[model samples]
Target: MTSQIAAGLLICLCATAWRMMRSLPAWLRLATGAVLLAGLTAAVVQMVGSPLQPVFVATGAAAVVWEQVVVAAWWLLAARLLVEVLRSTLFNRGLAAKGRLQGDLLAGLIYLAAVLTVVDTVLDLPIRALLATSGVIAIVLGLALQSTLADVFSGIAVGIERPFNIGDRVWLEGPIEGVVDQVNWRSVRIRTDGGDIATVPHSVAAKSRVINRSVPTPQRSDSVRIPCAASVPPERVAELVRHALLLSPRILAQPQPAVALVRIGRRSNEYEIGFAVASSNDLWHAKSTLLEQVLRQFRSAGVETADRPGGGATSEPDPASGSRRFLAIPLFHDIADDQRERLCRQALSRSLEPGDALFRQGDTEGSLFFVASGVMEVTRTVGARSSSLGRIGAGDYIGEIGLLTGAPHAATITALTPSDVLELRKEHLAPLLAETPHLMHAFEASARRGQALFDRRVAASVGAETVPPGQLLARIRDYFRVHHVRPGPDAHAARRHPAAQANSPPGGD
Candidate 1:
């Protein structure tokens, strides 16, 4: 009866081990392997008294060996289960999750300890006694694994210091620069930009200098130096540099750029333009772009570019009127020339690449945008899907509704081609509106049209009811602080009519 029960249990253990192969944990796999070996030995033991053979191993000691292996396998399975429980209840928590290598190492140690405990308790093995007797051999083995021990300790130090995470962009001394792929007990694997995986020992990683680009912040400070002729006013030179920087949409609006004359030489003045870009991913590219822009602007203004510290003097008047860009758009037609020039100076010019997002839906900034060139696609996200609103082209504007009404963007706007846009932010509008009280009315009709478009899109997107214009105008007046301006019919729909084609907003031209 004992032999039959042991045979059944052994068969069950083998089946269980086969089922556990899907698990990724090395310790669990090891324990499963041990179970398989024990089950094979137990099957032979069960056949000892059967017709297969009087004793499968032809010796009683062989049977005892099989039983001892069973004890060890059982202990290993118990340890593996305990490790799983600990992993779920504790080791998988936030901080511990960051130290996965350490967790695996600790689990491996627990598995070895379980084997030792089983040897001493069930098999009556004297583990400590053997170690004491073979102290010299133990010392020799430790010396043999010195490098391995060093790696384990070094890995622990790296984990604690955590200079970089698994996905962080890092560069080490020598040719080890890439994204960290994995951190293990003995080494780290880096996936280089070339798609090759490089495994480096933790000891080497701990000893070398590791620069983590993603840490602290990804923004980078850059400086561009250019030589300008003494003819152009320093203020005009600064303005030109600023305009060039603004043209690149990747540059952030905050931490405003600074341009200064660093050195005044006899022939030319050396100006240094210092600015921060959005990221450090392409430091060289950003520097190259700024240099190109500075040179182009200098040439267009006929400001001689000097090779060295000195500059040559040349004079060329700016042909384009300051208000030319604004006057092209019909919305600002009523503003006085001086006030229009102020708006133009306050506006920032941006060149956007095809597929770049001008603004996302639900953004609350009140900034008007004019499409100087190229086309724009407007979309509204409804639930899990998106619906197209319409397209805006040269001289057509969007975001004025949000800019004037202080409401969330009704739709997302994206560039359909390499496009140029003039952005009029709140800072540019508040002073103009506060000073010229009547100027507020210029936006009233435009605001109503924008709201109508938003309402129409909302209705078309989800079949929702249209909002009453009176209510929308009320909200608009409160947002723009234009209670004095009487509510009027929206000009957008009327302008779209055949009879009013002359008053229609400019399309792509």
Candidate 2:
């Protein structure tokens, strides 16, 4: 009867294990339960059926030890696998979905408890005595490991609060800046931009002053300092700095930009050009580009940036006086002084009140206009739908696209308020470009660059709604599974291809 009951129990356990294996992927579900059942059966048979037999007692004791080993191994392996899989899935879902280390710790504890329960049952241990002994040992260990315990508890608190996560750019109290590399039970890892890894204890990190550039938003504020001779007017310096920053594609428009006289050095007045960036990840790239553009503009204008150590002090040139005051416009800088003067004379200065229409959509591309002051609204009409592309402010040039390509005006340009514009007629621009072939190339290059900028903005707006490529591919794979599509010849071929197989590292046989 005992043999028959054991066989029945074994059959039932195997059938349950098979069902579980079929339900979950092999990698996700461990067969610990089946192993535990087999061990329990052997233990029961040895202990109850042949209690006084020395061989049965020895066999049961061995089986009990083996069961404990299996349980511990399974618990550790399953816990590790579960944490890794959950972390990966959650992280890929979104920034908000990332799992905290506290959850992982909790999973580990639960696995430990489950393994202990199995071992206690298999060995027929007295739970009350074991609990009493464990309590006494814990008390002694806790006193000896006060600091370690603090760190562990602090780690749990930090994980729960989540001041920052992996990939976050953070500046700690010591003003240490780095990207978060890892968050573990007792310490946090950060990778500094200088290519060094920083390991900060959780106890310190939990209470340290931290500035997370990736939290709230990834945007960061950056500043570019441009020094000028003390004599240059502050207002003029601010205007120049503002114009340069606005033209760059990388700089954000909202929150606008700020320019201030930061300091007065011994030889020069330093002005700080400050702007906000969309991401700290791209901060270096944006700063480099803005500085490059600013330098280019200053050089083109023939503006002296600073006084040399030995050179005599040079006073700022007056914009109103006859003394040559350079304008930083790219087009103006390209032409010769005499030609520029002629072009300036030929250009018409037009003023329009608010609500005035400068040019309607479909109008002939007759002339290009540069905004001298005030704002102009550029609106496009497609059938009944009308969209405002953007507003152009002072120092911004427009209508260049139509004038260059001879295409009809793509949008209507209307004055948002009283505005002044410098109109360069196509006829006047033609002769000047014809006289100077190199000038044509400069104008075309600038125009092309402007068009590319416009296209990028349009693309960014359109692409914002699209899903990431990886996510889309995952969804497609899931869809195939749901539809029960049989793997085709092409699928088999893809899997069997050398290129596909090459994704995994080569192994030496």
Candidate 3:
């Protein structure tokens, strides 16, 4: 009779467990159902109603022990299933929700509660007593680990407040600047422009004053200070600086650019050229192109910059005290003064009349041209269609990509107006490359930058009318006016003008 009752109880348990399994999630159902089946099998084996001798009862008792083991296994499996379900649900909801920081914290708390619930229910423990004890322990731990606790709480606060998000350029209290990589429970990870990763404790990050460059709008006004020789009129310097920034592709157009004479020093006058940029990531590149343009413009205009006492002579002057110091483009500023001088020397001046073709698309690459006086249009012909790539103006370089790759010119270069250009041949670059492998990296980097700009312009023009060859010339002219600069004269005239020659150092004497 007892054996029959045991078998009936096993059947009932198996049915109930199967129902539970069907009601559960797919992953949980498989794990929990397997455990329940093992338990039912053990219970059935232990049934004493089977017609057997005393030895059979002893064997049945051993099977009862196995049933207990199965029950314990079922509890473990149930706990595991609960944890996984809670984790998955919390993670999915947290990530999908809009306020990332708030969602993450809430999700973590939910996970913690779910874990505790699983422990209490599956293990059949008295949770209230454990909770009371944990509260007391937590208070003691909080006092002892003040800083760590602060960090954890601060991390939570960061999620809730969200001063910055991933990919934001932030300046923290320590004056450290970087793009926020992630926000975690204890710390925030930032990857600096130098490619170094910094882990800042959430406590510090939360309390510290942070400048979120990516917030509200990613655009920010940036300034570069260049010292001009006192000989150059301050008004002309300002105009020149403003014009240089306008020609740069990196400068934002909506805000417009401004230049001011910040201070006058013994050897030079310091000027600040201010402009807005679309992003902090573009800051370095924009500044580099700006400086290059400024130097080229100043040189073409017969303006002399302050020189370093030894051989590292620069074209800009030092500003007086109390003047706002401008930021220099980091990488380009690292080039030795001698290399820049060699580059200037190796460059050959040329002038192109309007309608002149500098090179066709299939022409062999020879030298890269840097615009020194006027505007040129770059066009690519693919199949029967011809598309305008972009316009090159004073200080912009062309043909570097093909020169480096030893490929035919990808685009046809034509003079949009009477233009001036400084040509740097591959042979002249060999000595520079041999002396500094770093220059090669710079050239390659510049080429990649040019390609990126080309890609962006091409993408923006997609679906628009294919800009006619004449329309391209008109567009180039419009771009110049919008930037507040006009092409002055042909390259040959600019080079031979009395003003340019007057600024030349006395060599015949």
Candidate 4:
């Protein structure tokens, strides 16, 4: 009896030590536990077979109580070892949130089986009667804890299905939208964008609609409804909204944002600007930025909003008002009003539908194009891989370098919408350059700025000295067939270029 008690104490001590050395490698800990359990079993076998067995009580059943205690302890140690092995081998490392719950449930079953075995095998009880009695008790407990059991089963189902994992951004039917923080047997914890933690139960989550935004890709599609005066053309409003979407860095360009008139009212039209962001979290910032950009674009183009206090929409700019268009251009801002009108008269208006190429890369046409209204994309192709350099919208100009330096178009310009472009050929500009001799310096400065920007955009290396101002001025004069080009007093000031300055608010870098 004393030997049996010693064996039980040895088993308990081994279990405590195994649990204490948790930082050890799992396999090594498991091996140590198996060795201890085997040693205890051997010690008990030897004690029961040897003549030196000790008796604690006179009654036969009580005399074997110590053996039963040792047997039960052995069974428990074996169950614990099996549980540890299963936990290390079959659960959690890849299972993520579902692993621990599954491990616990498995361990419970193993321990229950060990306890039943101890009752029937060690103490020699009637297994059939015991199971029959346990069946009724199980039914009673299951009914009493119906909701809890439902949660448990639902958690298992969730684990098996894996609709969303930890760290995924999800939307539940409870209107609960957030990043999954922690998932357990009872509930899933979500960290919301508003910095609040939401606990949603597995049963509720299973029954509700679950949206996993993190799967496949984190990109999220969103849109905003913009109210514009119905007086403005739908095509015009769509172009402006599309330009604003292209301007936003947070908004993705691959999907190509869309703008469409969804609703028309008595005095206003509602346009839906649909776009995508890199992640669900970026949706708000992208939307707000796009809205700001849209407002700026509308203001710049004199397009009125439906909510404008007077309820009267501003009329669109006259396409034939060349001088007014020239005044809006920063390039012609230095030209006097009368000279600008003459310059505008010499320019030719060219209209384009969407997908029309104004000029392609490597085209050496010595002409400048000014966007009267609409958006154009600038793309540069290098070794079969074409990348977008930027987008140009209303009031932006292109082909300055091609015109001034007689260089081929460094990038292709394609009309993104129904666009009105004004073309000024070198031949038409020479007489004006000869009359307004100082315009050569403005053109030189603008060309230099354009060349620098083009070089930066294409990632071309700039020499320590590119074209000198004298050489660039000579090239412009030679290209335009103009003689005796005079430098203005502000020519040196023009040399200190705002290289980073954007041509238009919607123009891309």
Candidate 5:
């Protein structure tokens, strides 16, 4: 009866150990299996023979085997129990949930403490003397791992300070700039915008000056400078450049752009066009665009750029480029080449700054502006709220009816970037169309198409009533005063008159 009971107990223990094998770590699983095997063998020997019996005593193999079994059960069982406790109670909590439990510093410390406890309790080993010698051992280890210790301490400091988090963009004093991808024990790994991975030692990174571009705010303030002849009025330069920058889509709309006369010399005046963008990534592009549009406007207005030291030299683009762009417009496509050329010659080129309004809703100005480059956003205001109506870019023109028919603009056109527009003002447009009656058909068709586009976007925005192209044409003719031709000379002679040129440069120059 006693032998059968020992055999039954061994079978029960083995079944329990087998059930838990998958949950154990590899070392723990081996320990558990070794311990259970020893326990089973002890139980089997107990059940198979009587102790100190004649046959059992002769060989004494069972006694030696039992001593080994006892040692294995003592150590391995303690290790398995401790491991289970550590995994279930500690690892499964907050750290495990975040997938960072493995190799965690605090957890490793806990494991060491548990191992010491098991050594003292289960092995019956007194470890107080070992604790006393630990200081000497630590000193030897410290000297061998001097660099590693520095990195570890630095990493700890970084964790506590939390200067930057994973995924934050940082520019370091070491000329390294990238987005932080991981923060490890000894180093930080970052992925640069160019797609290169950089590993920075924690000790160096901790000591370096760092700019966290992603923190506080990602918006970047930037400026573009243009040197203008001092003879040009400061107000004129500011107004022209401000309008030009308002056209850029990259620029921010608020905190309104400011132009400062930063430096003034006998030969040249330095004007800084200060503005902000939604992101630092756009800053360089925004500066490039502002410079291009501002310079183009100054050149077209005959406002010569003053040459200065360190101010990059200016290059004037081909004069024929503007005329060629003018000819590409649908309204000018049907108009005779000579008529288009005269119109282009008389047209005033304006630079528009981002968020600058070309014309407001219900504007009565009879002017057509064509987007030579950059973008324009058309918006409609109902009471105090505004909704986007549509947008236009290079090769697109706005205010056709206002230019050809003298009609009030139904929507407001705001610049989305530093933009250039060839403006055919009332003085330029009225006389041109009056002399060239055949151009009216193209004008009507173009006006209708533009109105259709406006109405289509308007319908999406507000679902308001739509206007047919015929009604749009009638409105255009009335506003342009095309019906009653106020006889003025062709655009060429009127524009060439010396008196007009003198008055023009005061504002136009």
Candidate 6:
């Protein structure tokens, strides 16, 4: 009765553990099995402590059969536990392939040995004949599963060599560019950029050339070709393009982007902009951002590309060009057409080479600047600490607070690329505000919004509280010396341009 209870408990534990195979870690399950095995051994010892009676000889045979059955179960459980430990070790050492192909093969051999030992010793079977028949069956199965066995063996090789681990971004000869999601016995699974899972058979993958982009380094290098008219000097084109490449925040600057006149044609010259990004995932965004900056840079420098209808730089600046540029600004959008033209005409255009500083952090210059083209970086210094606030691009304006309320520039503005800034002094804007006193309120609100955005981008915890809304309006009135006029509910709404939102600094909100 004692042995029977022990065997029943052991069976129950095994069943419970097997059911929870996926839920429980292999080491935990192995520990549970080991405890049960120890308990079973104790129970067996207790059963053996008592001697059998002579009158119960017939019953003794039945008892022996029951003991054999229990011992056989113990051997099978031990074999499984051993396999679990080995599998765990293999995974820890990175020796196990995805899906445990090598571990599974080893487990099969261990299980086969356990079964053979049980048949020979526990069940008392004819071992020699069984072995001979099993050899023949193994041969037949091997022949039938030739391709499957090839994959299994190839997977084992992959486990040992470890060409690329799961989650590594790899490129195959099939022009397959994607991340490695899984490596099962039969195939390697790749998740493409388009979110499709592609399965390549292990046999085929073994033969194909693979490039592991994730290994060594994750940075990927790419280039864009811009064609300019043969009339434009390559040196000028190269300098403009190099500055444009540097303007993009996505493109890495450490390796230093390269610009070269790679191809020359009778009608046009093609320059290649070579740059590297943090990863292949950033390639598209970096390329697009660089191209946009290049277009802005070329336009600002009066350079023309081959694709443009005129094939050469504008010989003379248009009279209305300044007005057109100013009209695009949201603050000047609502002003009368005549007012905009006069203001733009009076505005002074300042050209800055790369790394030029428009103003330093503590500059008290009470002036507004509009980004005509190219990109500029905004940085602020508070005491001993200096940090980048963000970047401002074309169609964006800066120095609003300084221009409106005579507030000192809170941040330093510097040219990241070849930039053209249109500087507007108080005298230039005075007439417009004089005619429309309500424009004071619009200017105040825009400045407030920009300051709030700058504060948040710096960090919420360290951000300083902005000036009160009414106080800012009052300050603007005092600075401009204009009488207060009630602004309409939607006075600022009609002045907003859709493109301004996208082209604004990082803190567009």
* Candidate that would win on TM-score: 6
Query: Which model is ahead, 1 or 6, in terms of lDDT?
Result: 6
Local error of candidate 4 at residue 15 (angstroms): 4.2
Clashes of 1: 4
Write candidate 5's Cα lDDT for 1-509 as tens digits: 46435545655675587586776575666566666656655654554342212122223665544433333343444445555555566656533432231336765665576557545643446798777789789999999999988988888887777788766778888798878887778888888878999988889988999888877887778777788977778887776676567545578877578889999988789998889888767878888767876765675445678855554323333445765775565565455545566666777788889889888877767777766666677788889998876565554566665665555567787887777777777776666555544345556665555556632343222212233445655555565566733325643344334233222211120
Which residue runs does candidate 4 get wrong by more than 4 Å? 1-73, 92-99, 119-163, 173-175, 194-197, 201-222, 233-263, 273-282, 285-302, 307-317, 320-348, 353-356, 362-369, 389-391, 395-410, 423-509
CA RMSD, predictions in order: 14.1, 18.5, 15.2, 8.3, 11.4, 6.9
What TM-score does candidate 6 reach? 0.80
lDDT string for model 2 (335-434, tens) is: 4555555556666778899899888887864576766654567777889999976566554565654555454667777886666667777676666544
State the lDDT at 144 in candidate 6.
100
Error of 3 at 14 (Å): 18
Global Cα lDDT for candidate 5: 0.63
For model 2, the run of ten residues with the poorest summed lDDT: 317-326
Give each model's whole-structure lDDT.
Answer: 0.64, 0.59, 0.59, 0.72, 0.63, 0.71
Instruction: Please give the distance, in angstroms, between residue 287's alpha carbon in candidate 3 and its true position after superposition.
Output: 1.4
Q: What tens digits encode model 4's per-residue C-alpha lDDT throughout 371-490?
A: 777777878788999988667666566666666667676677888778888897777766656555667777666556654663234311111123454587787777777776445545
- Compute each candidate's TM-score over C-alphas: 0.52, 0.55, 0.52, 0.63, 0.55, 0.80
Give the lowest summed-lDDT range of ten residues in model 5: 500-509
lDDT of 6 by residue, 102-212 (tens): 656778899998888878766778999898999999899999999988887777777777889877899999989999888877888999999999998888788889899
- The residue-level lDDT of candidate 5 at 383 comes to 90
Q: Which residue pairs collide, candidate 4? A: 1-54
